[model samples]
Target: MLLRNVLLLLLCLVAATPRSWADDGYRLWLKYDKLPNAAERQAYAQGMQFVAGSGATPVLRAASAELQRGLSGLLGQPVPVVAAAGSRTGGVVLRVDAQANAGGQPLKPEGYRIVKEKNNLVITGRTDRAVLYGAFALLRQVQTRQPLVGLNLSSNPRINFRLLNHWDNPNGTVERGYAGSSIWQWYELPERLDPRYTDYARANASIGINGVVVNNVNASARYLSAEYIGKVAAVAGVLRPYGQRVYLSVMWAAPKVIGGLNTADPLDPAVKQWWTAKSDELYKAIPDFGGFLVKANSEGEPGPQDYGRNHADGANMLAQSLGRHEGVVMWRAFVYKANSNGDRFKEAYEEFQPLDGKFDPKVLVQVKNGPIDFQAREPFHPLFGAMPRTPLVLEVQLTQEYLGFATHLVYLAPLIKECLEADTYAKGSGSTVAKIVDGSLDKHELSAIAGVANIGSDRNWTGHPVGQANWYAFGRLAWDHTLSADVIAQEWTKMTLTTEPAAVRTLVNLLDQSRSIYVRYTVPLGLHHIMGESIHYGPQPWLAKAGRPDWTAVYYHKADSIGLGFDRTKGGSNALALYRPEVQQEWGNAQTCPLSYLLWFHHLPWTQRLSTGRTLWNELATRYYTGADSVLWMQSQWAAAKPALDPALYADVAARLQTQRKEALWWRDACVLYFQTFAKQPIPAPFAPPTRSLADVKQLVQLYQLK
Candidate 1:
């Protein structure tokens, strides 16, 4: 008893003593841990002795504060902020020069230039916001352990508006969010501001993201009311200092629901007047509010279609409502019918393609990267280069709604880059989705790109710690589409995980191959939309029933005794015709089509030979088996990286990788077994058949649904 009491006293003393846990990922890539290299730390500290910039401007103040904070943390010493660069031997200076040039190249409005001016490094740009970005760039260099001597760097955002579309509701639940509750904290906003809001802004500003839509597209009318407008204004106030603007996703029925109007029709003058008044009221509350993101006439959301009007009519009304406010309306083109007999892939193109030049100048038709929803691998949306007159906002989802949620480590930069680099051939061979999205091809002044955010109230922001890489990758790519996926992966690995070369290379290789690894295991060879119904968790290739025909998995794969794959060519849905003739020619013929997209455009027999020299059946089974096995490789690579990574972060990913391997096996077994029933073939030699029968897999699906 005396020994137990002594032990208890020791444990109590241990608990009372102060101790610091390893990184919980709350700081994200901006951890700013003290530099381990003594030489580099001394060099950076000498170069950043003090920060000189305008303290009057909010953005400049933010830049100066961030420079001081970052440099202090990195150098293990406090850095001073001074009023002027005046005679400082080695320091950082921030200047706003509209005609600033770096390496004889002109800087865009939001672009920044960092060059050595005398003994000090000068970060100059056209606007205060750009100066802030330049400051972050300098800190990124230090964080990534890049050489700081004779630094010369210039970067311009290819897209005019880089935004995050949050699908959070007022009640604090995030739709399709794998992380915890919504970050907005609607119940406490307006009266109490979370310090997290500032950190969120800081993270966004570091990556050149300038705007955020605070609500879901399936919006609630309550957000438009005066009570909620105050709440939004409070949130905007927190973000404004970091050069970020707040936007709203408005419910089309707000006038009827909140304004007590008889009709919510866009063409109706009362509805128009109500919107104008509301817009003006919003501007009054938050002077720099970004405009509305509308999901009209899609997915049972009340829209102008309810009043016999088109998408253009609805979008134009909202644009007019903005009036003198410096904002633009982004109308989503992710529309399809519940009871349509035609190909769902062709529906959005058919509905919006005809009204190409009809939209208002301030209207941007927000098109998903793919024709369908954010599938694992989709051909670039046909509407990208088709509508020359209408500016398009390319929307991609960062949330892994269908890509194994938070359990799988699927790096999405490659998936996003694939769509951006696709040749549309709209204006000949040079036309690409990137060109269309940046407004260079159409020569339009306004352009934007949005990523459906995966952020939440979780300590790590995204549910999976590595999921932070996707958010970082989206912002980096949105700023400069020319950056390679490997480069972004390496940069992120260094900033967020480690600076060791071998560890960085291993992490980069893992990230570079992760998306494809997921694609092969889950939905290989261009197969799309075969995930579980509603929840979209695991494989359900046999799903033939749902609320709507298009929602069913079988509606996409079309696997039968004769063949498997969706046919979008002339002999089938003819969706390929939606693209330019050049693109159609490239993807139209099954015999010459790339194997990656072979199943997307044609249905081929199981016995047919592929370009890879394997029968379709054999190739399918091989991909399933090999993809599942790749998870083990990912686990091993991650294990190799543990020594260089934070213990908490490393263990977090290792546990998730185990979950990924199990699910990958589930996907492989379920898909292989289900498809085997149609192929009527044995698992090829050198590969074993799944231990679970088709019925057993179906039972698994039911079990998931029960959860």
Candidate 2:
């Protein structure tokens, strides 16, 4: 009891520290540093004399408090929150009126509009949560130094449920996570609510992410217990004021594992009753609990398939249990057979397409961005346009599991943008993946997009400083899918780093090119799933054995003496048939297909000439060599921005770039030399031959895979 009291006291102290004002990335993009120009600061100060609001509810109080905190720092003055501005001029007013609209523009639920009323700046929204978002949007204007006059900024989320799915385990380990440990303090929770929880909630709410799944999909049933429910309730309380809800990844056999039951079958009446009871228990603990995220019959997890039932049978059962509660069941569509000989890229489509209109209204079939696991680059999943009856939640991985695991300076905005902008052709030429995800393509009411969280216990949040850009980008893009990757990168850079023109342009350009550059060195020409064994790092093209054949590097690459790519065309696995005919027409012909995706659909001869005026082997060799060399250019760009960036922040990224340069060379040498044996060609011109042999690279990879 004494020790528990001490822990609770320590948590109170941590929560009282406000925001970390250090040069570290703890503040994320929310840093409200004083404006560098005093003239500009003074002008902005006039509009923020005092923040006026009722503080009637928790969210209302939160809005006024944030305005005070943000304006106090940015203007270098005391900006107090008051009950009312009364007749005062040149003050900020926050209003939550059901009839509020942005000037003449309309607002969807949880949307905000900022406009100048009389002489005061007014931020209004339809709901208290909308006003809270408005509060952050106003702070964003000051932090980015946008003009305060003539304000008519109206913003609404494109998707209904924007979320972050944390692959955090109950025991403090994070699956595929690189930053220190899990941020969730499981042992100290329920009694000791860390201040960091509030910070995490604010960061998500600021960018319009409305929900978070707090446990790993490869789940344990312990999270569903009465004891854990109390812990989750404490977390929900902290997040509730910010309009974010707590979600759990449920173990499929929770009925058997946590509750005493005969069989964990969804159709079993006893099992149905168990879930109904469980849902009630969960809502009683956390009234606004966001529903379950289930990963079953994929990678050895238990599921409805084990009991002679399909995915719809399982998902509908859980959705029915929610009954009158306002929640959703996100049933993951990432299923693949353990020992199947079929192409893994075609597996999810083959399985889920048959049950398109069969799902309950409250269920969403969450699909990954690509057909396979989160490769550096992949053709958008066929499931996007293929499943019109079921509302699909696009699940993207933010953790750099396959993209070098937080060490490489790869910006994932480009990767995500590529997938979003791709034409699914489900409803015609302009039927983009984004349209399908936002529910406009299918005319479905429910919509969502989730990013597998990269966040952890690191003071900087993400291990790599630039990694924060991906998190910010996800939220902005989720709120509005039409926002370009370049625009998002520029916005994040100006707000997080310096607003100096030259430095901002340089950093934005670097971020724009980082994903493609990483792809060129590591997995160029549509290469997929060839990373090292279980860790999914470095290069392992020679890897041929794993527990499952599909898990081997050799299974996907299919490199041979005659060719160097997977044959997904009709002549091979016929995976191209899964896409619409228009997409097939565009991707079918090797001569016309985009060079970036040439290898994904077809396997060409080593000497076959591409439209780039280079043979297959030569183009592959050039990208590998040039990709590694471009990391040197990235190092130079970072060095040039040193004058504009914070010293500690600049140093951290500079050091990571050094490690990235080393590992990029490792990827280049390992892949080039290994593939050379099959190509039987010299290294292309403007590129020197690798100093090391393929055997040498294989030995190094073997050592990396050692337990």
Candidate 3:
């Protein structure tokens, strides 16, 4: 009885003690932890004594509130938002003018200028939303521990529409989502707004993402119903203050599914009227509704094609429905057939290129970065330069659907930059994919870019804590495509993880090299779409039987006793013809082709020596071996970051690195052992063969499939 009483007392004492908070990454890069350097804090506090701005507009109020909150947290002192900057000294001032100029340079509608004026800084912009972006930029500098003195920053989004496409279903399951359940509590939404929704909006606003498509592209008709429109409006209300407009992915057959129409053809008068009324109802519910992202005639989703109509007919109909609503129709060009008679790479180009000028002015052809699905690496889609008459939205996958789900630590900035920097050679030598998507090459007004959201209900937003960087990178690059991958990595590292120079250097290197490492171990030498059937988790190069021929792994790699890789040259599928003559010349031949993409366009002999001076088999084995081993190097780099990082966050990444190393080995052994059957050669010298036989790897595949 005495011992039990002592234990109860001890429990009481433990409960009374204040628990230290763990960094669960919920705050993301906006941690705003108090400045470590007192001198630095004082300098920032002196420059930001108070925020002077009009709190009349919702976006202005949001900017003021953010400044106050961020300054209070960063400086350990309250920074009030004042009505005006009259006679104020050593404080930040905000000004909005529709035709504002930054240092004698004309500013875009959403452009911002932050320059030192006398003893204070003035953040002037052409619009309230631009001022909000300037506010975030100021906070970013403070968070990165940069001096406020002599600060001059001016920026504008390179692309007009930067959006996050959420592949979330109404029932809470996110398609290909690795984090926890969907963040949208659909059943409780219209009446009960989750505070997380507002936080999500703040995060997006801080990163300059102005639009969000809240539903899956493989859409549901229920989102168009009156009750669901109310729920969507609730979300929009939360995002409006942050200058984010909400969009929905509409089902092509919504008229028939929800509006009781006999035929849902784009040309049908009744169907058109039904869509027009529904769009009007949506605009009435949400004033700044961003419009629709449609996945029509693709992957069995009902589309105008079912009614003997084309993509232009469907997209133009939606654009007409929007009328003068200041909205757009983003028609997906990711269509393909089940029949595998032709190269999947040529399908989208063939189908969409011909009808380029047919799309309405308000319609943007949303093309994936690659012609195929989002592989680890892919040539820039031919459609980027092919369709000069149309405005194209460059869609990239931030969620690691085909890459390693949430388990692998892959930084996507390199992949995005590679595609962006790819010379399309559309008009001449200097034309790039970035120029095409940003409306500079064709000189079109409407342009957009989208990243398939990696976010979910996880406390960190993204499942893996490091996955947050990808979201951050996407936003930064979307705002300004010229920023290098390393620059973005360093910025993210300093803000999210540590300010220590040594740790920052180490983390940046890790992030910069991560994507290449992932590509090496998983799909080296441009081997694409060979992941496990349906789940896409692990290596399954031997995947032969699937519902569709193209769905099978063997259909892509074409491995045999002679050699490996798909033949897309003139002698094979002639898919190279889809690209320009320069691109075809660059990638068509085995000798001149970049080694990274050699296997993608050619089917060479196993004994063929690459530019790396290694035979094909030896190079493949070397990459598999070294790539798996590089995970240890990443672990070491992350370990060196512990002293400067949040303990909880450091430990979280360390644990994930361990998982990554184990999986890397799994990928290495599985691919090498399985491919050995085709190469019919032993593992290269200095790198030992995988002890596990091909049968063992096959068993692993079977086990993963069961999961």
- Those runs of model 2 whose alpha carbons end farther than 4 Å from true positions after fitting are 1-22, 103-105
C-alpha lDDT (0 to 100) for residue 419 of candidate 1:
95
Candidate 1 steric clashes: 0
Tell how far residue 318 is off in model 2, in angstroms.
0.3
TM-score of 1: 0.97
Q: Point out the worst 10-residue segment of candidate 3 by lDDT.
A: 10-19
lDDT of each residue in 83-114, candidate 2, tens digit only: 98899878899888888765466688799988
Clashing pairs in 2: none
lDDT of each: 0.91, 0.90, 0.90
* Superposed Cα RMSD, model 2: 4.1
Task: Determine which window of 10 residues in candidate 1 has minimal summed lDDT.
Answer: 10-19
Question: How many clashes (backbone N, Cα, C below 3 Å) per candidate?
Answer: 0, 0, 0
lDDT of 2 at 126: 87
CA displacement after TM-score superposition, residue 570 of candidate 3 (Å): 0.2
lDDT of 1 by residue, 1-707 (tens): 67755654454344333336888999999977677777777978888888897696999999998887788777766567788988776889999998887778888888999988888989999999999999999999988888878789999889999999999999999999999999998899899999999999999999999999999999999999999999999999999999899999999999999899999999999999999999999999999999999998888999988999999999999999999889999999999976777799988889999999999999999999998899999999989998999999999999999899999999999999999999999898889999999999989899999999999999999999999999999999999999999999988899999999999999999999999999999989889899988899999988898888889888888999998999999999999999999888879987788878889899999999988899999999999999999999999999998899889989999999999999999999999998988999999889888887889888888999995
Per-residue lDDT, model 3, residue 491, is: 86
Cα lDDT over the full model 3: 0.90
